[model samples]
Target: MGELAVRIEGLTHRYPEQNADQRALDAVDIRVRAGIITGLAGPDGAGKTTLMRIMAGLLKPTMGEVEVVGLAPIRDANALHLKVGYMPQKFGLYEDLTVMENLVLYADLRGVVGRERTDQFERLLDFTDLHRFTGRLAGKLSGGMKQKLGLACTLVGKPELLLLDEPGVGVDPISRRDLWGMVQSLAEGGMAVVWATAYLDEAERCDSLCLMSDGHVIFSGEPAEQIERMRGRCVHVRDISGNRRHFLRRALGSAQVVDGVIQGDNVRLVLKEGVERLDRALLAKEPDATVEPVEPRLEDAFIDLVGGGPDGRSVLAETTPEVRIGEGVDRKAVISARELTRRFGDFTATDQVSFDVREGEIFGLLGPNGAGKSTTFRMMCGLLRPTSGDAHVMGIDLKRSAGRARQKLGYMAQKFSLYSNLSVEQNLKFFSGIYGLKGQAQDRKIAQMAESFDLGRYARVTAGELPLGFKQRLALACALMHEPPLLFLDEPTSGVDPVTRREFWMHINALVDKGVTVMVTTHFMDEAEYCDRIGLIYRGRMIAAGPPDELKKQAADADTPDPTFEEAFIELIHRDDEARRKTEAAA
Candidate 1:
C-alpha cells in the first residue's frame, strides 16, 4: 500500500435526539492510503455521509481518534483545512455568479495566486470541459455541469486529500464517466481520494471499498473478493413477451428466490442456498422464456449481505381506491407532441421534437447534460410554453388548455420541491389542499400516505431532516396523492441506493399494472430497461427513439455483439457529436 493519508480508530457519532437509538456511526475504523481511490459504499442512513463529514472536519465525532495526514481533524481543523479539499453532497455554489467568477472567488479564498493559480485554473477548466462555459451563470448550467464546476472550485488549493460525497448523484452517464476519469487521474498524482456513493458498480471500480450498514463497517477489502462470495448463486432469466413485471412478482414470491431485478429483457435473480437451478416448468409457462447462469455483481453481494429482498409494498396507500383508466379513454396515445420547439433568445432548447406515449406504457427520455431533454419534458407537462407546435396530454391540448391538461397528469420535478421546513405530515396536507382535497378527505389521505411510505415514526420530523431515501419516498407520495391517470417523473431515482431503487420501481410497476402511464427522465442507463421505449435527445434534437433492445442492436458495431445500455448511450452520443462537427465544417 502507499503512504497512509487518513486513519480512524473507534469512530462514533450520534445526533442529539429524543430517542437513544439514533447513532449515525458506531465504532467504525478505517484506513485510507495515498495514490489510490477508496470508496465508501452503503444504503441510505448507513453512516457513509456521517463518516465523510467527520473526516472532513465538518463534524466532530462523538468518540474516536481521527487523523488526516498525521493531523487531528477536530483539534487541528484549521491546519488540516489547508491540506484537505472537501465537497459535501450539496456543494454551495453561488447561482448568480458566472463559472469563471466562482472559480476566481474560490481561488482567492484559498490564497492561490500568480502563475501557479493560472496553471491550476487552466488545467481544471480543460479537465472539466467547462472552458467554453466560463461566462455562463451557474444557475443556467445543467446538473452535470454544475457538479463539475463544484469539483473544480474544490481543487483550487491543490490539496493532498480529497473527499467527495455523492458527487455524481444527479449527473448524466457521460458526465459521470468523465468525473470518474478525473478522480482517478488525481489519485495517480499521489493524492488520496475518498468517494462516498450508493452505486455498487462505482465501488467495484475503486482500489478498495469499505461497506457500511446500520452505522457500522460490515466489510472492508477489494470489491472482487466480496463478489467472489456469491459465485454460482446468480442467474439470469429472459422473458421475451414483455411480461417482466409479472415474472418479477412471481419470482420474488418463491421461497427459494432471495432477490430479483429486471435488467434489459431479462430478470437477474439471486437464489437461496441449495437451490441449484430454477424450475424448467416455470420457464415453459411463459412464451419464449429462457434461463442461464451468470456471474455475480457487487449488487448481488450487497443484497445478500443486507438480508432482505426488495420491498413489495405499493406506493399508493391501502385506503386509496384502485386507479383505473377512464372508460373509452384514448389507449393509443396518452401523450402526443407534434413538431414541438422551444427557444430562448437566439438559442433553441428543443427543436422539432415529436413523440407519442401510449396508455399504460413507461416511456423514458435519455440524454447527456444540457441535451434539451428537460426542455421537451417541460413542454409536454405544460410547465413551459412551446415556441411553436403543440402537445396533447390525455387528449387535452397543452398549448390551448394547459390547466385542463395538467389536471390529467401528476408531475414530480428533478429536485425535491416540497417545503423543507415543514413536517412530513404537513407537506402532505399542503399538497392535498393544492390538489383541491378538503377536510376529512385531506386527513384520510395524509394518514394513508404516512402509513404506506413508512413515515409514521417520523411524521413530525422536518422534511429536510429526513434521509435521502425517505426524502424520495415523500416526494413520490406527494406526486401520487391525487392518483392522476398519467405521471411525469424527472430524474426521480437519482442518488438512491440499489435496494431503494428496486423498491421504487416495484411501486411503479404496480401503478403501471393498474393502467397508469408514466413518462420519465433519468441518468441511470440501467433504468432504461424498465421503460417500454426510450427517446435519445442531443443538442436540442431527437436523435433516436426505440425499444431498449432495438437501440442496443443499432449501437453495436462489428466488434461488439451486445453493448450494455451505458455503452450504447455513449456510442450514440459520440455519433451525433461527430455528425454535428461534420455539418459545421461543411457550413
Candidate 2:
C-alpha cells in the first residue's frame, strides 16, 4: 500500500473529570489512504470528534501515537497547519465579516499577500459558488453557504490533508449535493479528505468507510462489504395491524429480532436468536403479510453494531403513512400560511407559499436551497416580517401579534446556538425565564428535559463545549422548555448521527402524541415520511403540498413510473426547468 497520510496507533483519549477508564477513544488503530474520502460514522458520545481532533493535531491523545503528514499533530501543529485543513464540527465564522472579507482574511492569515490575493480569492469564491454573494455577511448566509465558506477558508493554504467534521449537517438538499460534489472534486485532485458525519446515506458515498463507535473502529472497508456482512438478515414485513408498530417495537425490545424499524406500514425485522417464537407469532398474526428479504444498508449495520438499547424501541419505524393527502388532518392545524412573501430589496425570497400544519402531527417542509422554504418558515415563526400575504400561528397573525404567536410556538433553529460561555443548565434556565417560567415550575421542566435528553450529567458543562449531537439536543431542549402547542424545527437532525437523530425524533414524536404540532424542514428524504403532511417549496413557491405518498403519486403521473419522493423532486425540478425554457423560447 502507498504510504498512509494518517496513522494512529493505540489511540486513547479521556477527560480528567471522566471516570479513570472512561475513555472516549479506546485503543484505536487506523490508517487513512491519501486522496480518498473516509467517512467517520457513530452515535452521540461515540468519539467521532475526538478522533478527528487527534488527526488534526488539536487534541492530545491520552495514550498512543499519531503520524499525520509524517509528524505528530501536537509537536508539529505549526508545520502541520500548513499542510492540513481542519474544519471542526462548529467552525465559528465571524458573522460581521462579509463572505469575501472572511475569505481575504483567511488568505492573508495564510500569507497570501498583494497581487496573489485577488486571483486566489476569485478562484476560491468561484469554486465555492460564493462569488455571487461575496458582499453578504458571513453570518447571513444560509446554513449550506456558511459551510461552503468554511471549507473555502480551510483550503487557503492548499492543505494536503482535509479533516471535515460533519460538514453537510444543517444544509439544504441541493446545497448538500453541491458540497459533496465539491468534496469529490477536491479528492479527485489528490487531496485526502476525512469527512465525519452521522448520516449513513452520506457515508455510503465515501470512497471508503471507517465505522467508529465508542471511539473504536468496529468496521472499516467499503460500504458494500459492510452491507454484505449482514446479508439476507434484513427483511421488510408489512404489519397490517395498527398496533403492529407497538407490538414489533416491544418484541424487538426483548431482543426477539435481529433488528426492527418501522418502514412505511411495515416492520423491517432482523431475525436474531431467541426471537424465533415471537417471529413465528408475528407471521401467524399476519399470514398475508409480505416479508421479503431486503439488502442490508449501512443504517441496519449501525443499529446492529450499536446494540438495540432501550432507545432502540424508540427507533422510528420507517412506516409509510396510510392516509391520503389531507385525509388524516382531523385536528385544526395550529399554523397556517397563505401566499406568504418576503423580499430583500429586489430579491424575492418567498413569492407565494401556502400550507397548514395540523395540530398534534408532524409536518415537513422540504425544498432545495434558495427555494424560499426558510423564508416561509421564518414567517411562520415570526422571526421575519413577510412582505405580503398572511400567516398565523394558533390563530394569531404573525405580523399583528408576534409575541402571542411566539408564546404558542417553540422553534429550534438550524444553527444550534446557546450562550457559549454559559453552562448547559444555565442555558436552560435562560430559556425558561424567557418563557416566564419561575422557580419550581422551571426546575421541574429542566429536570424532566434533562432526563429525556440525557443531559443531566452535562448540566454543568458549558453549552459551547458540548458535542455536536448534544448541542443539538440541548438546543431542542431549550426550545421545548416552554412546551408550546407547536414546534418549528429547522433541520433539527441535520448532520447528526443516525442514533442521535433517532433519539431526537423519538422525543418529538412523543410530544406530538400528547397533542403538540410540529413543523420541520429537513434535507434527509427518508425523514419526510415521518410527517403527516409535507410541502415542497421551490422558487419562493409551494410547488406541491400533500402527504408524501400522494406527492410521489402526482409526480409519477399517468405513466405509473416507480418514483420515490426524491425522484418526484427531481422530476418536479426538471418540469420547472422545461417550463422556464419554453417561456423563454416564447419570449
- On lDDT, the leading prediction is 1
Candidate 2 lDDT over 1-587, as tens digits, reads 23489988888899887898688999888878777888888776778888988888889889998999888899998888888999987796889999988887888778877877777787888899888999999888878899999999999878899999888777766677889999989888888889988888788889888888877889888888877777777787764565444545454555466566554445666765333334556566566676778777888777777775344433111221222223343357568888888999999999888777776778898888667888789889999999999998776788999987788778999877589899999999999999999989889888877877788889999988887788998998899777676889998887777767767766666566556778999988777766767888877877777877677777797664757566677677778778879999999
List where candidate 2 sits over 4 angstroms from the true fold.
92-95, 112-126, 134-136, 239-254, 258-280, 283-289, 309-330, 433-442, 555-564
Candidate 1, residues 193-258: lDDT per residue as tens digits?
A: 999999888898999999999999999999999888888888988755858887887788777788
TM-score of each: 0.97, 0.87
lDDT, candidate 1, equals 0.88
Prediction 2 TM-score vs. true: 0.87
Error of 1 at 512 (Å): 0.3
Off by over 4 Å in 1: 240-242, 281-284, 311-322
| Count of clashing residue pairs in every prediction | 0, 11
